[model samples]
Target: MLKDFSAQSLFMGLLTAFVGFASSFAVVLQGLRGVGATELEAASGVMALSVAMGVCAILLSLWTRQPVSIAWSTPGAALLVTAGMPQGGFAYAVGAFAVCAVLIVIAGLFKPLGRAVAAIPAPLANAMLAGVILGLCFAPFTAIASDPLLGLPIFVAWAIVAAFKRLYAVPAALAAFVLVMVLGVDLSGDPAGGVISALAPPVAFVLPQFSLAATISIALPLFVVTMASQNIPGIAVLKVNGYEPKPGPLFAVTGGFSFLSAFFGGHAVNLAAITAAMCAGADAHPDPARRYWAAVVAGAGYIVFGLLAGAVTAFVSLAPPILIEAVAGLALIGAFSGSAVAAFKAPETREAAAVTFLITASGISIGGISGAFWGLVAGAAMLMLLRLARKEA
Candidate 1:
C-alpha cells in the first residue's frame, strides 16, 4: 500500500479535489445562507464540511484499501434552499443537520433503515431532487439578465469548457467568477485582509437548537436526498469499478463525520459519485490495487481548500448575489439533467415522478415544511392510488 503512492495518483487526487470543491461549493454556501446562516456561519459550514469529508475519505480509503471518496451532499444542500428559514434560524438548521446525520448513521448500523431509504421509488426520489434544484438551475440564465457583463463571461466560460471537458467546466466557471471579482467588481478596504485571513483558517461554531419544524422541513428531506442521490450512487460507482467494500461501514463512517461537523453548521457528507469515479477509475492509477492513494491525496487537498473557506466566502461576497448564484447554478445543471432524465425514464412511474417534480419546483411550503417533503409524500400517494386502481381493473 505504501509503495502504491505515485506521481499519477497524486496528480489525479489534486485534480479530483479541485473539481469537487470548486464545482458545488457555491451551492453549499447558497443553501446554508438560504437556511438563515450568516455569511460567517456559512463559511464555517464550508470549512467544517470540507475538512470532515477530507478526513473521512482519507480514513476510509486507507482502511479499506479502496479509492473511497467523500463529499458534502450538493442535492441535500439544494433541498435546504427550498426549506425556508425556520424560527430558530441557523441553530435550527444545525439541529436538522445533526438529525440527518444521526439518521444516516442509523441507516448504516441498522439494515432495515438502510433498506427503507433504498426503497424510496427511484423515479420519485429523482423527481424530488430535480424539483429541489430547478430554481438554482435557472441561475445562469437569470444571471445573464441581471448582470450580463459579469455573468455572461462566467456562463460562456463554463459552456466552452464543458464542450472540451465536462469535468473541468464548473471549475472553469469558478475561475471566471474569481477573475470577475478581481478585475470587474470594485471592492473597498484592504482586500489583502481577506487573502490573509485564508491563511489562518476559520471557526464559527454554533450551538444547535432542535425543533419539529426543521426536522420535518429539512432533516428528513436532506437525509433522503443524500442517501438516494449521493450515497447509493457512490456505492454503485465503486462496484462498477470493481471495488467491493461493504456499504454499511462506509455509510457509518461518513455519517459519523457528518455528525461531528453538524455542530459547526455543516450539512450531510456522504460518499462521492462523480469524484468517486475519478478516484476509483483507471485515471487515478493504472494499477487498481494502489489507487486508494488517489483518494488520500484528494482528501489532503480538501483540507487545504478547507482552510480557505472564509477567503472564498469573502471573495464571493464581493460580487453581486446573482453572479454567485450563476456559478452555483452552472454547477448543478448536470445533476438536474441527470435527475430529470431518471425521473421520467420509466413509463410506470412517470406520472408520479412528474407530480413530485412539479410540486417541488413550485417552491411551496406549508406549515413551515418544504415542498420537497410534500413532493415525495404526494408522489407516493399518487403511485399508491394508481396501483390500487389498476388492481381493481
Candidate 2:
C-alpha cells in the first residue's frame, strides 16, 4: 500500500482532514464553553479530542485495511450546546462524557446492544440530526443579513467553489472566510492582540463528578445521538461505497478512545460520517485497496492540527462570535442537506421524521432532558401510532 501511494490519494487525504477539522471545531469549542469550561479547558478539550480521534483513525484503518475515519462527535457537541451546563457543571459534564464512552463501549462489546442501537430507524435518526444542525445551518444567511460585508463574500466564495470543484466548496469558503476575517476586520483595536500562538500544551486532567441528572440528560442522550446519528450512518457510508468493516470492533475502538479522552475534558469519539465518504469514495483513489492510506494520512494531519489547538482557539476567540458561528454553519451545509434528504426519503416515515425534526429544532427541554432525546421520543411515538393505525385500517 505504501509503494502504491499516489498524489491523488495524498490530496484526498489532505482534503478530508482539512474539511473534517476546519468545519466543526468551532462547534466543539462552543460546546465546551456551553458546558462551563474556561478558555484553557476548552482548548484542552479540542486538543484531546483531536489526538484521540487521530490515533483511533490511524489504528483502525491500518487494522481493518479500510478508510475507517474517526472523529469527535459533532452531533454530540451540538447536543451539548443545546443541553447547556448540567447542574454539576463542567466536572459533571465530564463525568457524563465518560459515562457515554462506557455505554458506547458496552454497545460495541455486546452484540445485542450494538444491534439494538443499529436498529434505530434511519429516517428518525436523520431527522434528529437534521434538527440538531438546523440552527447552525442558518448562520450564513443570518450573518450576511446582519453583516453584509463580512458574510456575503464568504457565501460568494462557497457558491463559486461549489459550482466548480463541488467537493472543495465548504473548505474553499472557509479559506475565504479566514482571509476576509484577517484583511477586512481590524484586530489591533481589541484589548488582547489577535496573534495566534502555536505553543499549545497538552490536556489537563479533570476529576469526574457524576450526577443522575447529568447521566440522564447528557450521557444517555449523547450516547444515543453518537450511535444513531453518527456511527450508524458512518458505517452505511462505507458500506455504500463498498468498504465494509466489522461495525462492532470499530465502535469499540472509537469508544475506548472516547473513554480515555473524557479524563482530559474531551467528549465522545466515533466513526465520522462526512469525512468517511471522502476517504472511502472513488475520489480518494482509483484502487479501493489503497484508499486506506488516505485515512492514515488524514489521521496524521489531525494530530498536527491538534498540536496547534492553542493557536486555533486563540484565533477563533479574536473573531466576532457571529462570524465564528457563521463559519460553523457553513461547514455543516452538506450534512444538513444529507440529513434532510434522508429524513424525508421514506413516504411511510415522513410524518414521524417531520415530528422528530420539528421537536429537535424547537430546542425544548423537559425535566432537564434535552430536545434531542425528546425528538426521538416524539418520532418513535408517531411512528408507532402510524403503524398501529395502518394495521387497524
Candidate 3:
C-alpha cells in the first residue's frame, strides 16, 4: 500500500528526475573529457554517480520517513570541471574526493561541524548559495561561445519552444534535442554512431592513490568547495522543502558514496540541490511520501545509462553545442532566480552576500580553491566583523 503507484506522481517524479539527470550529465561529461577519460570511462563514472545518488536517496527517504530524493553532487561535479579535473586530473581529483569524504564522515560522526554548519544564518547561507549557483550557470554559456555555430542554433530553438509552447517541463530539453536532429550536427564523427553497444557492468574495484601533496593541494580544497558549495546548499534545499533529516547520517552516506565512486573514476558524489528540488517540488509529487521512488527511478536510469556509456557518450556528442547550452541554461533558470532572491534578502548582510556573489561569479582562483569558497569565507568574515563591531558599541 505504501508503494502503491500513482501515474500522475510517477510521471511528475520521472520528469523531474530526468531534468536533473540531463543537467548533471552535461557537466559530468565535460569534466570527464577535460581529464582525458575515454568516452566509455566517463560514462561509467556518470553511471556510478547516478547509482550512488539514487541508492542514497531511496535509503535516506525510507529511513527518515520523508519524501527525500538523493541527487549526484552537482556542485561537486561543477567544481571538478572548473577546478579539480582541470588542475589535477582524475587521480588527484579522486584524492580530493577522499579528503572530502573523510571530512564529511568525521563531521557526521563528531556532530560539531554539522551543527556549526547548520548554525550559519539562513540569509547568509542562502546568499552564499545563490552566489555559488550563479557562478555555475555561466559554464554552458561559455561553452556555447567557444563553439558558436553549434551553440546559436540550439539557443534559437530553445527560444522558439519557450515562446510558442510554454515548455516548462522536460519538453524544453526535448525540444532542444529535436532541434539538434533537425539541424543535422554531423553524427558521423561519433565512434558508435549506429551500434547498440552492450552496457558495461559496474567494476567492483578501484585502487585509490593517496598523495600527501595531492591531498593538501587538491583534496583539501575539493572538500572545502564540496561542503561549502554542494552539501550545505543541498541540506538547505531539503529544509526549504519541509523534509529535515538528521544531518549526521545524510553526510555519512553521501561521503561514503563519494569515496566508493571515486575509486571507479567518479569525481565526487554528494547530495544534490537543484535535482532534488525536482523530486521535492509540487510538480513532482503532491503526496511527498512517494517521492523516494523518484530517486530510485533516477538511480535505475543512471545504471542503464552507465552501462551503455559508449552509446550514451556518442549520443551526447551528437547533440549540437547550442542544444546543450540552451537546455542547461533553461534548467538552471529556476535555481539561479531562487538563489538570487535569497542572496540579497537581508540588508544587514547584503554587502557580504554581494561580495560572495561577485567573487564566485568572477571565477577567480588562488592556489587551488575556487572563488566560491573564498567568497563565502570573505563574506562570513565581513558579516562576523560587522557583528563584533556593533557588539562593542
Candidate 4:
C-alpha cells in the first residue's frame, strides 16, 4: 500500500478533500439547523458527517484498491431545508435519518428494492430534486438584495473564477465569503471568546425518536433523494472513470456509516459524485491503479477538516444566517440547472415533470406529509393519466 503512493496522487487526493469540504458544507450546516438544531448541534452534525464519510472513503478505497470516494448526501440535506422543523423536533428528525439510512442499507441488500429505486423516471426524479433545491439556489441573489456590499463581492468572485474554471467557482465564493466576513461583519460579543477556542470537534449524542409523521414526511423522501441524486450518480461517475466496484456493498457500507453517524447528529452519507471524479480522474494519476491513493489522502483530509468543523461553524455563525444560506444556494446551482434541463427534455413527460417541480417547490404539506413526497405521487399519477388518455384516444 505504501509502495503505491505518489506525489501527484497525494496532491490530487488532498485537493479532492479540500474541494469536497469547502464547496457544500454550508448546505449541510443549514440543513441541520433548518430542522431545529442548535448551533452546537449543527456543528456536531457537520463533524459527524465529515468523519463518517471520511472513514468510509478510506476503508472502501483500501478494500477495493480503487478511488472509491464517499460523501455526505448533499441533496438529502437540501431536502431537510424544505421539510422544515420536523414534528417532535430534532430527535424525531434524527430518527428519520436513521430510518432513511436503514432503507439505504436494505436497498443494497434487496435487489428488488434497489431495482425499484433505480426504476423511478429520471425526468420526474430530476424535477423533484430541482424543485427541492430551487429555493436555496436563489440565496446568492437574495443575499445580495439584503446586503449588496457583502454579497456582491462573493457573487463576483464566484462568477469571475467560474468563467475560467467552473469546478472552482463555489470555493471561490467561499473564499469571498471569508473576505466579506472579515471586512463587513462585526463579531465583538464573544461567547467562546473567539473562533480559535472553538476549534475542537463538536460532540453531541442525540437520542433518536421515531414518529409516524417523520417517517412519512422525512425518512422516505430523504431515502429517495439520497439514492436518486447522490448514490446512483456517484456509482455512474466511478464506472465512467473505468472502476467497476460492486454497487451493493458500497451502498450498504455507506448506509451503515450513515446510520452510525445519525446518533451523533449527522444526516446521511453516500458515495461521492464530484469528488469521486476528482480522485478517479487522470489528474489524480496517469495510472488507474495508482488513483486510489488520492481517495485515501482525501479521506484523511476529511478527518482533519472534521476536527476543525466546530471552529468553522462558530466563526460562520457570526455573519447573518442568510449569508451562509446564500453560499449554500450557490453550491447547489449546478445541480438545480442540470435537474431543470433534464426534467423538461422529454416532451411526453414534460407536464408530469412540471407537476413534480411545482408541487415540490411549493413547500406544501397535507396530513403530515411533505411536498416532496406528494410531488412524486402527483407526478406519477399525472404520468399515468396521460398514458391512459393516450391509450383511449
Model 2: per-residue Cα lDDT at residue 296:
90
What is the per-residue lDDT of model 2 for residues 1-393, given as tens digits with 9 covering 90 to 100?
578676766766776676677667888878887888776777788888998888998999988889998888987898888888989679999999999999898888888755654555778877877787688788889989988898888889888987887666666676877798788787654322432345756467888999999998899989988886678767756664566567788888888999998888899899986677667766677788888988898898888778888765555555666665676566566767777897899999999999988998897866444576678778989999999999999
For each candidate, the alpha-carbon lDDT, in order, equals 0.81, 0.79, 0.62, 0.80
Runs in model 3 deviating more than 4 A are 1-44, 65-103, 135-170, 191-198, 202-204, 207-221, 240-242, 280-296, 388-393
Q: Which residue pairs show backbone clashes in model 2?
A: none
lDDT of each residue in 290-391, candidate 4, tens digit only:
999999999998998888886654554577767766776766676577668878999999999999989989978664445666787799899999999999
TM-score of each: 0.65, 0.72, 0.73, 0.65
Q: Worst lDDT window (10 residues) for model 1?
A: 190-199
Q: Write the per-residue lDDT of candidate 3 for residues 1-393, one digit (tens) a residue.
A: 366455544554555455556545767766755554555556667777777766676677667755456666555555556553434346655665677778877767778767865665655555655665564356446646767665555556556665775434434454555565657566566344433344555343445566676676556766776766667666766665556657777878888887787777776766765566555544445676665665556555655556655566556655544455455555555656766786687788888778766876776866545665677678788889888987999
| Best-performing candidate as measured by lDDT | 1
Query: Model 2: number of clashes?
Result: 0
- 228: Cα error in model 2, Å: 6.9
Runs in model 1 with CA error above 4 Å? 112-198, 313-393
**lDDT for position 330 in model 1:** 75
TM-score of 2: 0.72
In model 3, state the lDDT of residue 227.
Answer: 69
Q: Root-mean-square deviation of each candidate, in angstroms?
A: 6.4, 5.0, 5.1, 6.4
Cα lDDT tens digits for candidate 1, 1-393: 778898768866876786678667878988988999886788789999999989999999999999999999988888788788989689999999999999999888987655654456778877876786678789899988887888899999999998997766766787898798888888866542333346467778889999998898899988887876678767755664666767788898899999999998899899986677667766567789999998999999999888887765555455676776677677667667767888899988889999988998997866444677678789989999889988999
